[model samples]
Target chain A: MAGFFCLLLVLPLFIQGFYASLLTMTFIYIIAAIGVNILTGFTGLVTVGHGGFFAIGAYTTALMGKYLGVSMLPGLFAGGITAGVVGFLLGIIFLRLSGAFLAIGTLGFAFAIGSILNNWSIFEGREGISLPHNSIAGLKFGDVGLYYFCAITMIFLILFANSLIKSSVGRAFTAVRDSERAAESSGINLRFYKTLSFTISAALTGMAGALFAHHTNYVSSETFGDSWLSVDFLVAVVVGGQASLAGSILGGAFVVLLPYYLSEYRDFAFILKGVVLILVLLFAPAGLSDLLGRLYRKILGKIVRGQSDVSCNLRD
Target chain B: MFAQQLMSGIATGSLYALTAVAIVLIFRNTRTINLAQGDFSMVGAFMALVFFQVLHLSLILAFVATLISVIVLAVLVELLVMRKIRNADWLTLFTATLGVYYILHGVSGWIWGRDTKSFPNIFSVTPVSIGGMLISEAHVINILIAGGIGLLLFLFFKYTRAGIAMRAITDDVEAAQLMGIPVKFVVTLTWAVGGFLAAFAGMLLAPIIYVSPGMMDTVLIKGYVGAVFGGLYSIPGAIVGSLMIGIAENIAGGYLGAQYKVTIAFVMIVLILAFRPRGLMGGQARREV
Candidate 1:
């Protein structure tokens, strides 16, 4: 795992320009995917409106830095904080409903946010807003610098999520997901944990949006808060391994790079995405990470058995 | 002016009501909400275009063909895709429907292209003045057709054996199956009925909005809001709920701005889900836990 991350960190040094930017985008999505996993995988509550939170993060960052003239770091913090606060409130109302109803409600919430962004003059409506170049302490961060920054932040967030999942709160989230009644009987507060999961997930996703704003230097309701983007995020979380951090990274990479490779067939992309999602759900419901884990175990088992056979033959 | 708006609202509400009925039917029988409900209508509109505009078929023949094809498509989706994951959770089933949504949306775009095609009007384009209110012939035809379909459905449910079996399954799937109600067949029939209603609604709406892959998106969202607003489980409730939405949105668009019309549906959805989850005519809320 350490070696794999080292390879990722050094990847930008070997690949420059477009590929580097693409990798940067992948890193951003990886963060967002992990954020989604926390809510959907851990808490067992699917939200099709995380894109709304993502948009809030981006808009907050852009507005703060461009209009309010705040620094990049503060703007990013503000973005995450804003999205977290909103998620905390929305979660209270939305989490009351479960399953399909919740999914539809969140979907409506996303469209509502999109509608607000499109009509509100403060958001510049559909015209969108351009983000200023990010700088801190007299050091300007261009594409290369942004790539490094995103990679480091992604690594840190991954570690944070790893620790979080091992905590008691994480266990409560899993318990709720597995059986809400059982968890409730066992003294887990379903409402509180669910709300907390949403808040944390939104904050992480919002931070990713902040990075996206800085990287792209633009914010638009169509790009950020759209239903398609929400589906894309869900696709990433499901494809990677809903329950695993490693899965999220893999899923994010697949989502970002697959389209780049298949860019030649632009119109077929939607069909391909739909087909891929269906195939993944049917064949590997646990996701690609689980598949990889199984493969690893099989290989290790074969090697150990082969070694044991050789040793027995020599002794005989 | 007020009367004209009211008439138009009722006409549009009729369209939404049909779509809402389709949504409610699928939700009731399959225990799954088909998010692709609107996309099925989009497919129907394109099929109508192929039959009428391309092949030069009669309007009735074209409409029937569109309805049959959409019904086949819906059944195939249930049999091929949904059957495999029958035991999956609501989230999984919902996502599967979303997958269907994407496939239908993409295929329609591929076949019809991205540009909107002008759909031929089924009714005359002339307007008739009634007591100082001028209403288009299309609107009048739309209301009549919607009323006819609604009446037919009501009668079918009330009098038919298949309809009773469907009602049994919706009321209690396990009990219906144990009673030898042919639960699977009834469920498939429910999907067919949903497809029929969606296609009919699409045909009614095509003349006004034009035939495009993306045309039913707003209508679908509004239909969903209406369904939820009325009580997801009740057909009559869905109809009334959709009518209310139609009138409210038309008024909001006229008095406020047209841009805010879509937002009104979203706001209504949130409000309904928050305050009255069971909706106006829905039964008691059953907690999953």
Candidate 2:
């Protein structure tokens, strides 16, 4: 897996411009998916408003870079922090509700964010904001440079997420997800873990938004703040396998690459995506990651059986 | 101006109330939010367009056909998809509805093309003055039709056997089943009725806002907020909540600026949920274990 990712990272350098940009976007989406998975999969809280957080991050980075003359590094950090703080406050207010109510609340939040972005003058309203060139130490990071930066950041985030899920906090999250009452009785602070999950998820998503702003060189209300964007994130998480880290990467790649491959059938893309989501939920509820895991085991089992048969023949 | 705005707000609020009632009915019975509720209305509007505009049917005929088609679609969705995943968790069901939402949206776009279609107004466009206040004939008719439907629904729930059975099932599904009521049929019936209400609201809204694939997005959100604010399971509460939302948004648009109008619904949702999660008229908090 490590070797494959390394190859992917380097392959972009050798690929054409469009493919390179596509791969970079895939990486950015992977980070976003991981962020969503932490909240939805690990904590068992569904949010239809992460798009709002993403927009907040993008706008923050764009505004800071454009107005305050902050470079990309600090701008990205500020964006993440801002989104995280917002998420923390929202989670405190929203996590009290469960199931459908929570989903509706998040949806409303996403719409509210979009409305504000579309109407507010400081944010330039519907016209959107242009991002300054991403730079570090007076060195401008163009397309290739930004791709490398995103890839490295994605790799680090993946590792960090992996370790986080394996830690005590992750266990608490899973416990809360499975049974909140049981988790509470077991001495897990449900509120704390839930809020923590939201914070971490929002921070990562915000960072991805920062990267997206720099890549697109523009931040708009429609792109990041729309409720449909939140649904898209949900689709990616479910398609990849909600519970698995690798699922996020696979889901991100699937989502990003599907449009490219189906560019000719642009009109049918949404229908196809909807069909995929339904089929996956009905047949493979665990998502594509579980299917991949099963396939891997099956192949390994066959290889081992063949080796054993060859050894037995030699012994005879 | 205040009177006119209030009257217009009431007119729009009636539409929201109808949509909310549909949403509340489904949620009460099935425990699913039906995220595709808006798409259902969108499809209904298109169906009406096809009937009235393409087929050149009379207004009443077009309305009836649209309602029938919407009911069939809703029933098919319930039987084919929702029933198959009856035991799935709330989140899975929600996601499934979202998938359905996307499919409906895409199908409408594919069939109707992406452009907005102008719907011929069924009511007179002339304004009628009541004392010093002026109101459009269409607005008056809309309020009357919506109110009439609400009253009819109220009587149906109160007097009809199926409506009584539906209430029983919503109160306790297993208990209702044990009492020999066809639980599955009632659930399906509830969805059909929901479809009817959504279609009716959509047809009414088409003239004011042109029939488009995305026309019901804001309406659905407002309706959902209303339902939640009124308490998800209560019919009367949903209606009252929707009226409040309608009036509030109009006032906000008039005073604060039109841009801030939509944000009012969202802010209301957040504030209401934060302060009272169960909604205004919800009975008791049933904490999920």
Candidate 3:
């Protein structure tokens, strides 16, 4: 809810196309990161195939809009549902694998998705898909409007995620993440929770992908190629702070915005980005959120100290 | 076509095995899945590409130079970048490698453009046909070289003092350290060996695939699949896993359309891991003391 309000205030400022595109990318990433965090950070499962569901959402939307002349409303929802199903199927079948093994397995699925997108002549291969513009509820979206649409969607998802975390189900997920043996001993269904987290994460990521397809009005195999896209999500989730919704947004922004700033420096910037990721991982396992929390406490302490000193002096 | 593709798969599987073994080596020692390993391979192949021109050497000489360069590159990274943070948490090591992944990727891209370049053939040009299919000479040579290296590595690890020290470190890092067995040096050497193997895979692979900064990106996933399927900690497992992946990939490509090839490989990995997280060979769970 706070993030939605934050978006409401900030969406108006990104009137330009480039910044709007950046915001769109940011939310797309935020969706993926949050989805990933659900699996890796919250539930202790690793998946690299969110990109597959992401591609599923993208292609479903693009194909619907392109061929069926469907409205963005239906196309977007269809995209998310399609990806959700894929995630669900994979979860039922392969969620048994945890750790890096699962990570690579899921990535293989992404690779398969990429190849299908590439070789199927109907999908347009490397040339890419052009999409119809989206509008809803008496409003035709310009760059800024669509940016807010994405932002609004992202905020809703984040709040929903927060709510889920607070519920009994959230504790179940945390329990499973900490230890399957213990969770099983405590009467929790380990298989069910693990699979459910993977499914839920897939659905969330698929939703992001659907929004992305509509937002870009363009899609291609390259859009979800290799670990570049997955790595971006990983970097955002890590840099922003895992296990926190705020961290997802901040990480998305940091990963996206930092690049735009670095593009100014050209080639050297790539090296710097890599270095930054490495350094952050090595030194800040708790991520930027911990740093901010520390800073917030320090500022509060100083203010409290000053106010108390004044009151004591007056009393004296 | 079946025979040729089978031979080619076997040959490439050798390269896959080499890469996966390197991954197994590092994972064996540190338990860190070094994503940077592939990028290191890219660096080696790129170094071979650049130095090939400057050294004015034959393809064999270029391969040797590339191997040496990448080994140094690996060792240096281990000593400077990885060693400093050895005691960091797991996520820290994983994330640090992501940094290493990009740093090498960016540096390689900056030095060499994103364009794909071809390499000179390190071996012959004729096709060898045991049956009706055509097996290229390069495939034959690649298989030979990979097999020879695997044997040497196997022997070295089994027989040499340095190799036993290395194995001891993987068995118990702190115990080895207490035994005054130079654990840090072994780790760096492991990275160097990893870098060397990845470079070898790249150098051999350059002729087979195009050379680019991201050339090994997809292959890295395949290698990971192989390593995990074999058991991350098991060398023999990696070898078997790579060959299985190669054969499966070929069969899938033939039976299913090439479009579904990647999907097949991925589905197989996912299926196997889900059923057997310990891999085909199984891994022992050991807690650090």
What is the DockQ for all candidates, taken in turn?
0.60, 0.68, 0.64
Q: Tens digits of per-residue lDDT for model 2 on B17-57?
A: 98899998988888888888888888999999999889999
RMSD of 1: 3.7
- Which whole-number lDDT from 0 to 100 does residue B256 have in model 1? 93
Model 2 segments beyond 4 Å from truth?
A305-316, B284-289
User: Ranking under DockQ, best-scoring first?
Assistant: 2, 3, 1
Q: Write the per-residue lDDT of candidate 3 for residues B203-275, one digit (tens) a residue.
A: 8888777799888886787788788876787788888888877877877788776766566666667677778
Which portions of model 1 show Cα errors greater than 4 Å?
Answer: A306-316, B284-289
Model 3 C-alpha lDDT per residue in residues A68-168, reported as the tens digit of each score: 88776677678777887888788877756666667677777777778778878878877888987787754678777777778778777888888887788
- TM-score of candidate 3 relative to the true fold: 0.92
TM-score for each of the candidates = 0.95, 0.96, 0.92
Q: Which docking class does model 2 fall in?
A: medium
Q: Write the candidate numbers in order of decreasing lDDT.
A: 2, 1, 3
